[model samples]
Target chain A: MKLELGKLTIRDIRFSEESKISEGILYVSKEDLRRVALTEEKIKSADFDIARPGESVRITPVKDVVEPRVKTEGPGGIFPGFIAGVDTVGSGKTLALKGMAVVTTGPIVNFQEGVIDMSGPGADYTPFSKLLNLCVICEPVDNCEKHQYESALRMAGLKIASFVAGLGKDIAPEETETFETPDLLTGMKAFPELPRVAYVQMLQSQGLLHDTYVYGVDAKKILPTVLYPTESMDGAILSGNCVSACDKNPTYIHENNPIVEDLFKQHGKTINFVAHVITNENVFLADKERSSNQTAKLCKMLGLDAVIISEEGFGNPDTDLIMNCKKIEAEGIKTVIVTDEYAGRDGKSQSLADADKAADALVTAGNANQLVRLPKLDKVIGTMDYISKIAGSSDKALQSDGSIEVEIQVITGATSEVGFHTLSAR
Target chain B: MKELTILTNNPSLKESLTQKYPYLRCGIEYRDVNFLKLLELVRDEVHKGARILTHPLDGSVKPMETPYKSILVEKSDPGLDLNSLDLIENAIMSCRKFHFDERELQPRVIKDFQIIDRTLMESAIDTSGLY
Candidate 1:
């Protein structure tokens, strides 16, 4: 399949009389945009706000960050399966709004959400601080269930993103790049002399609030299977998880996955970029073993020399990481795993809950348990009333002086295992 | 009374332990014993009801923490038979393994493996508990 991803770098975002893009500035009609999210009966109230880079703003209880993009010339629409109907995508042209994100806020399930600081010492630890965030704060109707609230907030974010991206469909793209992958037989035949490399991408599929969706299907039901590299590139996978603010891959990261981009960068020059082996991190031990066993068997059958396995969450998923590594290495295939650490406040405890000598080639994405003091921002977009009860905070988190103490885990995408950020520990 | 078995290969250290932790005065008994002899004693004690036993392990290593165990094993001689001590004797399989299909660069190469995958895991000496 072939996909041409067009990019338009957004320099500024502002609310105006009508939504349009001009001179790299995105003007949004707040009333019209708010209408898109408020259509859902579960959402009681909806509002649109923009958080610029280097602003004195703090967004709390963030659910997901989505990049606005429209499928201009594809077989299926953007974000196919969730907002768009389930149809084969990633074969034609898709336009992505560069340098900005649609951040969804209003964590009705208080502790399950994350924080985003547009500027501060806290901002330095997160990637979202660098983007021009168009945050959508939505409140669920009275007595809404946590699951219903999560969906309400998630759909609101995607609806806003889809509405904004549709505006860029007819505009001239600033840049365009094409990516293509051949069938298994052809890929092997073309790069007969190069080493075969594939990616074993583990999806966060534990359950309930901690879930990820693929083609609008729950990831927990999926066994180990193969995917074209471009499938994830065109919004085939999305995050619906409330696992941890720092480590969970938001919908934005899944669409612009760094591993997929970097591996494709070395497609034929250094290695034969093969297919992606997708698997789930189920809660059951038997499910973990079965998924990993199937993943390893596929790697061996594909004649892959090596694979890069990237994980989504921490704790229970660490076992799945080791199992995939050990079982794959047992088939004479070298594997490297990407993951983060939760080594305690002192940074002296064991990093992972599981380990194996077979998992030797490993890269850590920093320790999420490190504490930091977030200075008060001039403007707070979401409420700070629930800060003390959050996972990374204590009763003393909200100080009298207006500042708060919290672990980096409270910050969105602070310690991503997909090598998305620069923070790491020795 | 709990028997404090000192499984030591040094005679002077044994003498030092016996002198340092003297009986009746400290309300405890110290016995000098070999490593194999301690295993035989443990096997005999297993048949009888053992009680109120405690052994302080090295704080650095916790075996249970790493369930899929990987340890550094030295090339040593075979151990004593404990069937005579009323213990069920399982047949000894080959302890030397190459579960990784690794090519050896030199003789007597040391390779690490997850303990459960190793043939001798059931019989493997989990010395972490014994120090």
Candidate 2:
């Protein structure tokens, strides 16, 4: 499978009478976008706002962030399962509106939601602060169930992102990049001298709020499976879980996964980049055992020499991570696992709930427990009612001076397990 | 039908699960305890040969961050399951590492935590096919 990813850099974004991408500036029609968001009756109101790179604005209780993209010439659309038919994607041309994101925020679904400060100390930890964010604040109808509200909010973000991306369908891209993944036999033959490498990605599928979807199906229901790496780039996977804001892979990260990008850069040079194996992190011990066994089996069957594994949330998933590492290493396959640490505020605690001697080659995505102080910003895009209740925040989070002191966990993408940000330890 | 038992500190979950399923078929053990205490209870049950059906740790919320926890386990027996014992012991240790103080949380926030706990258990029950 091959995909031509066309990128159109968005220098600026503002509300205008019509929606279009003109001369690297994205002009959005607020009413039109709101209409798209309100397509679901469960969303009582939809409001739009814009936060730039250096603005004194904050977006709180953020649900998901999605990059605007349109499949200009492909067998399937941008988001295959939800917005488009479940046709096989990752072939043909797709245009992405770079330098901008559609950030969805609303009433806190759970305590796991995050915060994104556009400027000041908090902005340094989160990558979203640097993007031109079109904030979508949607309120659910009264008496709406928590799951129903979460679904409504998740769909609203995707719908608005798709609508915004449609404006770039006819525009010529400023840059274009191509990614190709050959069949297993051809790939093996093409890179006979290089070491065969694969990536094992763990999807959060603990339960209702902690879930991921592939081709519109709850990932928990599916067994370990393999996919062409380009499939994820074309929206074969999506983030629907409300995990910790920092380490959670939002829809935007799934669309522009740093691991996939880096791996592709090394493809055909230092490594073979064989395939992407996806597994779930379930709540049941039996499910964990079965999934990890299947994952290791797949890696061994692929004839892989080495594989890079990345996990979503911590704790419960740490057990899954260790299980996969131990099982795969037992097959004589070298493994490097990527994950974040909850090493206590002082950084003097166990990094993971479960560990094994086999997981020696590991990459850490910083510590989510490290505390930081976020100075008050002038403007707020979303309600701060839940700031004190969010993960990594305390009841004393709100101060008389209007500043907040919280763990980096409250900041979105602060310690992305996929290496989405630039934070590293000495 | 497989014998299933639910141990939870969330009163709402206990009431809902008990009302939905027959008492004899699905056992609901409701205990008034904090998050760590609830895990201790599950550990005690596991020592008596109860097998854990669901993960003791919730994926999203930290241990001390939420006051409620719901764990599903098989009926007690005379023989112990080493896997269950290992998992429960690890979960207890993991909970102690996080030092979040949830005592000062507002009522609305506590209610939100309860809902999250209940929903996760509901998902487990949905896949359990016990209904």
Candidate 3:
């Protein structure tokens, strides 16, 4: 018998065997073949471990497998690019993107309306330091209580002093307690007249804008911070523990601040990302069953790497949030969870899982550079309509392979009209 | 009654209670891991009015026990596995948060693990009580 082996394509190979042996072809004589068979029998006496990248199979007669001369693409070419989405928990997109899971929010009222609010004096506008490299970004500072803030800032040499200290006035109640730390002085100074424009400009001057990944843009404008200020309450409202007042418009906060527009104008080219407003509810399912289903579904939607529970544990909204985060983090994805709270130390209302989930979501969302919005819909039909909206009324929904596909689940009627128009338009 | 103590891997949450709630007197014991056993121990303790604690790096134990005291309402911990540890960790983290005492809670780092580096352990340390 004749045996042959050779490379077929990039990272691929083929082996073939034939009954007739040819001269000058690394062939063995009949006697030699019998001797080889005897040698194989003898080799069975010894034990050895073998490893191979691709599958290996044994053939009794050593039949020939034709070596087809075909072009092939390596793993590098076929691998999927980053995929992300922001949808309501029960929407079932989570199940679609399981492998590339980046950031997932809880339930939301309006994901497209979501925004990032960093302006005014109380914005805590600190330059991006190298120490914050490992720290995940969180919103609203409510998640980061005084203790958690102090700990996070401890290495950075910043501390949480008094919340009411720097508001341009001596708002510190006459009986307000004070901390004996440098943070009090620094915070007081930074707060009174925060140069929001100068601060972001200076940071941008340092090439921070270029360093960060910004995602999303419409044909007309970039949507870096989808300003859903309704969920973006003022820090003062957040400070008062009045959860109901947390919703504010991001555009209002941005438009009101001359500094924000100035920074945007300067770095808008570099920070060409779009924003979508989403509610805190989108990320946090109302119940455990919904949370798990949403998580599992989202994982499927995104194609996440691995889903592991947080060191803090599992179940509940926090656990659901963290597990979703871990799935993204394992892939080294950047996410950002836009919210009005920090990762508090006390595992009281929200668990570390919850906080970390927000952090991971923010970091990954930031990295993916995709704007997702989760809005609450009063009507079930509205959900389908929203999906249709995202799918595009003028264009077909593009698939992972860039092929046009139609989803007829709830948007069957909408897709029909779009499909007819698309075909006729084509 | 026999003086029973709850052992957890989370020394930070354990230490917070000692400083925050003066009325509650108990020691939070730290163990390397039996993880499941830790949950059983926490449940055993919370039932007997014992304090429980947790850390992000302490690994999973059980869910947190809810509403231990009026101050410690809305505590939640869902252990990695469906066990008691998740309950206890959530309970402790929650208690440490909403529970208001005249004095602020102070959390201290108790270095018990030799394998875990300082940074990993430090992150796990919830120093919220100190603030």
Candidate 4:
């Protein structure tokens, strides 16, 4: 897949107490740019046009810097994606995912709605969605009497469900897209016959994948199913107040993180470690600045990667947090995560950005379409559309003319108030 | 015909300076000489076209609140005796680049001293429970 990516320029600034005796100039560093300018090494070798006192000295246009170039446009269609329905306590994340399934299926899909009462954010739905196409309806599975799984199948209106006589024969086209209604058994108000559907009963562990069979009209097909721990399968989800509060102290980090030993387990995957700082209510308001400086200091003292700060601290464009880490990852530091700076509100934003920015930022940051915030449903649907379009195109998403192409769309939904949500591609 | 001169922080070192430079007369002008004042005298004498010789503890040399100062001689005349003048000049230059502040400039200077007490430092290590 051709990933449309933004052009990057790296400028390292070093300062003295008094004034800058030397300063580097800015220039395009992409390989394509190298075709026009002399080689960076050669240019730097030449007299750097002695910089006058305050003027920035142009070191040979930083050349041959590798930048992300989009190889192809995204696919067209729903793009076969998943949604993590993360919702806080009392929020309607499961209902929303179910609602979405109904809208896409084009029928009155009345499934037995499994309800669960919880006190914090819903379960992590991203992993579950990855494991199964079926939206895992989360509920306190032990207490709930009627198996929600069975009830969902019953709601699929068995009458509307088509049954094939032979196991291998092709089913009628009309029977493929059936919405199991609760009352209708054979025929629906609109369609003459019902489509094929199936009921499944299985106990699966969290994050584990289970195989399921659907007895549709055409043939039996097996698919993956995931077991989620909560009822609200999707929506905006975040760290609970308790976890957020506990993540601050340096002592807590040492106590929590296994450090070099545990790091091996996630050596290649991104792992963010949040360190909470204890502070009075008054200081919490301005804690963003204080915490960021502290994070930088701690990271430095440990002799950890300097790039770790990019994952741990707040920055402008909000997207820099992601793009910067992507740059680090590109350099062979396989995994990246913030080990500190998750204290203040902005820290929370940066923490979430660290997750989304890694992939989304590179592909979407430079797109001019970034400003338009679509309604919530529209955003999800639009992402499908954009992905489909890009995947279908032949022209490289990264243009030869040296211009960045982006399809940034702000997905506006009834619940933008839920704050930031973290999504990892891997 | 030496142009460089050195002033001693110690009155006794003045005799050593005269012997080292040979070209210029050494010793206090006996006008309220202190560390900084001696340095000012040497620099003034050097500017006045007299060759001079000095030691590391030249009275003319001033040390800040820092424990050690740059120990060197100021040449009032560059055209004096090259051999002996060069020896003193090289010695001062070597020490100039090496830092001799509160920190040790040489390992020998702190060989037996305890830079940090191992037991005390270890006690400060935090064993308290982390949040």
Candidate 5:
């Protein structure tokens, strides 16, 4: 299959009489975006706010962040299964809003909703800080179930992103990048001498607030499966979970996975970049065993010389990461695993809940336990009520000085597992 | 009854602990792991109340009859999923942050041994008082 990505560099976003893109500036209509978000009755009401670079703004209880993109020429549109039909996307032309993100925020479902500070020392760890964030804050109707409310909020982010991407539907892209993945035999034939590489991406599927969706189906219900590298960029997989703020793969990260982008850069040159495997991190032990066993089997069947395995969330998933690494390496396939650390506040505790000597080629995405003090911003998007009770915080987090002390994990996308950000420890 | 939970991530800490604190009775270890059992303890002397025991890993074990059955989860307030939520909580709980530039992870394990010493001393006092 083949996919061509047309990049529409979005330099700025503002409210306008009508929604459209001109000179790389996206003029979004509040009524239009809110209308799309409130389509789901689960969301009591929705509103739009903007946070830009260098702004003294903070968005809190952030549920998910999604990049706006649309398929200009394809069998399916962007976010194929959920936004559009299951038409098997990633085979045609697609347009993307390059620099802006649709960030969803609302009531804290669990203590896992993250914080995205637009500026300050706090912004250094979060990747979303650099993007022009169109913040959507939603409130659930009285007494909506936590998971139901989370589902509504998750879809709202995707819908708003889709709505904004529609503004540039007809605009010509400034640059286009094409990606193609032929059948196994054809790809091997083309790069027979290159090392065959594959990517094993784990999805957070512990259920409740920790979940991921593929083609609108809950990932926890699915077995390990293979995907085309382009499909994920086209929104084949999405973040539908409220996992701990730091390491969870938010929808924005999935839409523009750095490892996928990096692997493609090396695709035809040094490595074959043969396949992409999607696996789940279920809570049950049997599920972990089954998934890891099958993942190793897939690697062996593909004749992969090496593979990169990236995990989502942490703890239980660490076992999955190690199991996959050990099993795959035991099959004679070299493996590199990407993960984050929880080496305690003092950086003196063991980082992982599980570990093995087999995991030699490991990449740490900083210590989530590392602390950061975020200066109070001039304006806050979400409520401060959740600040103290949030996962990384105790009642003492919001201090008398109004400066909040928190771990980098409280900031959204701080220690991304896929090398998504520059924040890493020695 | 007072209880002591061993808090350590060292796998060898469990083995070394049995030899280090011979008087301390062993209890169930709770880890987030799916395994049924992690260690074994056979006792010739059963002491009543205020047990000092340790199960030094991440997961939580099932509740047992003894008061000291809580594993690393209950022993430490550092949070359950060490790599994600716990990392965030512990870092914030410290109030102040410090960087560790040392390449060695030896300090963390060494500190766990010290904890074992202090906890065992307290348990020894409690066990002897039962007379």
Candidate 6:
């Protein structure tokens, strides 16, 4: 499959009477976006705000961040499962509004939400701080359940993002790039001499607030399956998981996955980028064993020489990572696993909950327990009431001077296991 | 399906499981213990030949971050399942790695933890087909 991605560089975002992209600036009608968000009855109120790069703004208790994208000339639309019909996507032309994101925030549904500082020491840790963010703050109706609120907020963000991205459908793009992945037989025939490689993406599917969806199906219910590399670019997989902010793959990261992009760069040149394998991190031991067994079997069936496995979240998922690594290596296939560490504040603890000698080739995305101090900003887009209770934060997180001290885990994308951010250790 | 028992420290989880699966009310065990003690209870059950159906450290909320945890296990008295032993032992070891401070959390936040724990256990039960 081949996909042509057209990029519309958004230099500025402002509230205007109409929503459109002109002269590299995105003019959004706040009322229109709010209307889109309020379509869910579970959401009692919806408000819009903007935070730009170098602004003294902070967004806290963030649920998800999504880049605006639309299919210009494709078989299906972006976000195949949720925003669009359950059609197979990943071919033809798609337009993406670059340099901006739609960030969702609300009352803390769970403690696994995150924070994004637009301009401060904390801003440097999260990539979302650099983007022109259109913040969607939604409030749940009275007596709304937590799961109901999460679902409403999640759909609201995706709907608003899709609504904003529709403006770029007819506009010309500033840049265009094409990505193509051949079928297994064709790839092997064309690049028989190059090393055959594939990527194993582990989706977080614990339950409730922690889940990922592929084509609208809960990932935990699905077995190990193969996807066209280009399909993910067109939004086949999306994050509904509210794990730790540091390592969770928000929808934005899924739309712009660094691992997929980097592997594409080395495709046809150094390796025969064979396929993309997706498996889930379930809570049941039997499910874990079944999924990992199927994953290794799929890798062996694909005749892959090497595989790059990326984990989402941590703890019990670490067991799945090790199981995949050990089983795949047992098949004589070289495997490289990517993960982050929770080595404690002193950096003296075990990095993972589970470890194996076969996981020798590993890439660490820093430690989530590394402490940092975030100075108070001039304006706050989301409530700070939950800051001290978020993951990696403590009771004494908020300082008397209005600043906050916390582990980098409180910052979104700080230690992404997929190499989304620039943090790495020697 | 085999006889499955759910061990949880969260009161909300125990109530929900019993309410949802009324027939399995006899198997749901609710203990008034902290997160670590709940895992110790599961470990003790594992030593008595109970197989861990779900992972002890299931959620990504960290070991000590959330005060509630629910684990599902097969109630069969088969010989010791080494996999269950290793998993529970590792979970206990992982729990000790983190520093647990008794901070007063908001009532709403505590309720949120209970709901999350219940949801995770429900997922395991859904897949386990204990009904």
What lDDT tens digits, residue by residue, belong to model 5 across residues B1-131?
Answer: 33344432334445545665566553323343211122211010111212212212211111110012212212222223323233223222221223322222234323433332233223322333321
Best by lDDT: 6
Across A162-244, the per-residue lDDT of candidate 2 in tens digits comes to 99899989998999999998999999999999999999999988888888999898998889999889888888899887878
Which wins on DockQ, candidate 1 or candidate 5?
5
User: TM-score for model 5?
Assistant: 0.78
> Per-residue lDDT for A1-426 in model 5, tens only?
899999999999999878988999999889998899989889988988999988999999888999999999978877866899988877899999988999999754435678988999988888899999999989988877667888899888889999999889999999999888888999989998999999999998765566688887778778899898998888999987776788888888998999998999999999999888999876544567788999999999999999999998766577778889999999999999999877767778667766678899988899887888899899999877677545465546777889999878788888899888868654
Q: Which ranges in model 5 have alpha carbons more than 4 Å from their true place?
A: B1-131
Q: Compute each candidate's TM-score over C-alphas.
A: 0.76, 0.97, 0.22, 0.17, 0.78, 0.98
TM-score (0 to 1) of chain B for each candidate: 0.26, 0.89, 0.30, 0.28, 0.29, 0.89
Error of 5 at B63 (Å): 16
Per-residue error at B123 for model 4, in Å?
40
Q: Which CAPRI category fits model 4?
A: incorrect
| lDDT of every model, 2 decimals | 0.71, 0.89, 0.21, 0.20, 0.72, 0.90
User: Chain A in model 3: its TM-score?
Assistant: 0.19
Task: State the weakest 10-residue window (summed lDDT) of model 4 chain A.
Answer: A98-107
lDDT of 1 at B86: 21
Which candidate do you rate higher for lDDT, 2 or 4? Answer: 2
Provide the DockQ value for model 4. 0.01
Q: In every candidate, what fraction of the native interface contacts is reproduced? A: 0.00, 0.60, 0.06, 0.00, 0.00, 0.71
lDDT of 4 at A371: 18
Per-prediction interface RMSD in Å: 19.5, 1.5, 19.8, 32.0, 14.5, 1.1
**Candidate 4 residue spans exceeding 4 A from truth:** A1-129, A133-285, A309-426, B1-131
Candidate 1 or 6, higher DockQ?
A: 6
Docking class of 6: medium
Tell how far residue A51 is off in model 6, in angstroms: 0.6
Per-residue CA lDDT of model 4 for B1-131, tens digit only, reads 43222233333333533453355332233333433454455445545544332222211011221122112233544444443343334323322322112322233212101111111111111111010
Ranking by TM-score: 6, 2, 5, 1, 3, 4
- CA error at residue A151 for candidate 2, angstroms: 1.0
